[model samples]
Target: MRLVIARCSVDYAGRLTAHLPSAPRLILIKADGSVSIHADDRAYKPLNWMSPPCTLKEGDGDVWTVVNKAGEKLIITMEEVLHDSSHELGVDPGLIKDGVEAHLQELLADRIETLGDGWTLIRREYPTAIGPVDILCRDADGGTVAVELKRRGEIDGVEQLTRYLELLNRDPHLAPVKGIFAAQEIKPQARVLATDRGIGCVVLDYDALRGIEDDKLRLF
Candidate 1:
């Protein structure tokens, strides 16, 4: 990871044109080749960013250019650099993840019945060509359900779940696979989109799920 705090101005040219006036900001360059400019506010959200699969080149006198395959270009001109540092974060162990979302997935998988009566999890991290589905389950009628879990459900989550359903349903055994978008909090727009596509939306309760799991463990 590379961090640079500098007084800079940024301009993005592509589908839309945007310019950030000269100001002091933080520039983050990640190992994945992604670059983002951030102000002190807005939490972790970047003011501007170029996602991975892009290239960055440094020019003379504090100027940098980043370009993507789509011909998008982000030009950054730095007036002065206040701080500059880089760190090598080695290969990460798989165990480190978003605690809440990971735990929610585990709890839901262990207690698949929470989804519906007689519903049982077939597997967690069910593999698909593009990516893994959070949970695969068999419903009461023995129909397959592909679930996508998220910390905050948004339109993109619904879209992702829809893509998984499209792929899973292609399999002979899992044909007609239903989709369920489960999240701690779901946006109204996302719920509307899911409903229109016939995808089920579930608002998960972390503490409630943990309590249910505890009760089951005690019984066993």
Candidate 2:
């Protein structure tokens, strides 16, 4: 990973035009040839980025250009580079969910009908071009369904599920696949985003699903 802190301005030209005036910000370039600009806020989302399958060119006079296949361009013009450095972050060991999440996935896979009557489990960790989906199943109507489990669901989880659905739907066999974002507790924002994307949300009751009834949750 290459991290550079610089006082630079950026302009993105594509479906829309945006300009960020000169200011000190973090510039990140990854080994994958992806580059992103970040400010102090919005810790997760970058101000602008060019995802790989793109090309980056460093030009003299302190400027960097990133262009993608669609001709969209991100131009970074530097005024003063405060810091620039690079590091080799070796290949990452894929993410491991906590015990609760893992157990939830197992329980849900066993009780696939919890999501809907007659829902049948197709497979767990269903392989895809991008990554493995948590759980793949078929609804009562025989329609394909993709279930993504999260201990505490957030917007990023929804986005991940969205990507899986996009790829899953591309296969003729699963051409009309739907998605269910299941989590122990879902944030309001995440729920709204999922609904906007036409993805259903299920607030998981971990203990209940595991067949361990908790007295507090009982309404008697």
Candidate 1, residues 31-131, lDDT tens digits: the string is 76778999999887688988655899999988899998678999999999999999998654333449889999999998888899999889998987656
Q: CA lDDT of 67 in candidate 2?
A: 98
Which is the leading candidate under TM-score?
2
Model 2: lowest-lDDT 10 consecutive positions: 210-219
Residue pairs whose backbone atoms clash in candidate 2: none
Model 1, residue pairs in steric clash: none
TM-score: model 1 vs. ground truth: 0.57
Candidate with maximal lDDT: 2
Model 2 agreement with the true structure over 1-220: per-residue lDDT tens digits: 9999999999999889999999999999987567889999997888998765578898998888999767999999999989999899886654687888889999899888788888899999898755789999999999999999999989879878877887788899887999999999999989998998799999999978988544566789
Off by over 4 Å in 1: 94-100, 107-148, 154-182, 187-220
CA error at residue 140 for candidate 1, angstroms: 17
Candidate 1 achieves a global lDDT of 0.88
Candidate 2 residue spans exceeding 4 A from truth: 1-21, 27-36, 41-92, 212-220
